[model samples]
Target: MAESADASGGGENKSVHVCVAFNVSNSKMPAFCEAACKLLAHAKADKGCRRFDFQREVNWLRSVSNEEHSLFMVRQGWDTADAVEAHVKSPHAQRFDGTLVSESMLVCAPSLSLFGSAMTTSDLAAIAAEARATQGSEAAEPAGTSSRPVSAARSNGSRPSS
Candidate 1:
């Protein structure tokens, strides 16, 4: 992992950082955490990978993120734009991404934000398009309640917890 540099740093900054949040059910929290451990191992192996943090939020009832159920946030940083892109395309990322981007593990697509000098607005748009493609397009549903099957939001009387 390289040193994280910003405007304060002496050289050009081409770093990128991504923050993603997932709303998971208590039933799947343990499994998700276990998967994250493996993901971290992959991150550690990438020299471009700098920061990786996974945090559980207990006070979601008061959270501004609007994530109801249980929530976990992952923040990762890379030294270069190419590094960020490559990390995501890596097999390890795909292994968990299939589950993370699916309703079986998350109530919905995780809230995501990308920031850095190396990434551009077009890059953000492309990333969003890719996410939509992964989730598959959804037809318009009536207002009120969602007909979509949200596995993590199932009302089995089990409260969502990390």
Candidate 2:
């Protein structure tokens, strides 16, 4: 999974949060982990990377119930979307393709997702307040109006002072 600022409009800064999962059979776990470690080392060395970490599920019962194969999760944070794009095209990332497909490894193709959202604090407080107010209510707020303060600042073309 990757989340970043929207690229559609002007003055929008782009950043990314990415997580990828790889499934490997128990027998191939060691090899897969070694390859992942090598990849992580290179990724961490990249200037645009803010974070790069890997984790293996340790609960056998949960793994058996959800997936028979071992699961490894790679989490990463990039300073910008361009950084992520560059990393994907880097030679180190390219090498992983061969390692993942090697005869001794049972790693499956990784699952990935990317999301983009506008980065702004606008209306957050109002939304949070409304959520708190409606914690146990079943009714939804009306279309044009909000739960009190929602539109107060936006209507004035200014953000509420933090």
Candidate 3:
């Protein structure tokens, strides 16, 4: 599944999302790619993992072929930060490190947006409500909670902007 983001304001049961960029070495490209794909599958199967996948940058140069280094982007999501950390320490990850990290750099950081689910007006309103509810006010309800307002688009057939 595609990676989903955390829109909940309560910060309870927050999904931990990470985007990692990798630079692989020359001779290790094939092996590294194989290991990475395996690790991604393994991560996705782990508990609390919503998504785990890798993407390679497409090259525009058709004739010259400038393949100095390949870039890979990995997206992973978990129910909590600790769960994500545990996923990183999994056996598949350890195998990945042994196979791909000999001469490569891995840069990981949080993501503002993720791959799953499109944005909608109702989604925004629900998030706002959740913020208000958590802040101890009647202004709005919580997003994921049952107290939040349901999406009108679902019943009225309203389409959100792209």
TM, every model: 0.59, 0.60, 0.52
lDDT of 1 by residue, 52-161 (tens): 88887756456533334576788888787678778888999898788666637776656766666565567667777876874554434445455556557545222333
Off-target runs (Cα >4 Å) in candidate 3 are: 1-13, 60-66, 103-162
lDDT winner, 1 or 3: 1
lDDT string for model 3 (20-116, tens) is 6565444567777777778877888888888787876566653111345555667776766667767768898878776654545332221223332
Candidate 2 C-alpha lDDT tens digits along 29-102: 67777777788889999878988898776776435213446666678877777788888888888787577876
Pick by lDDT: which candidate is best? Answer: 1
RMSD of each: 12.5, 12.3, 12.2
Q: Which stretches of candidate 1 lie over 4 Å from their true place?
A: 1-11, 64-68, 101-103, 117-162
| RMSD (Cα, Å) of model 3 | 12.2
Candidate 2, which segments miss by more than 4 Å at Cα?
A: 1-13, 60-68, 104-107, 116-162
Which candidate achieves the best TM-score against the true structure? Answer: 2
TM-score of 2: 0.60
lDDT, candidates in the order shown: 0.68, 0.63, 0.58
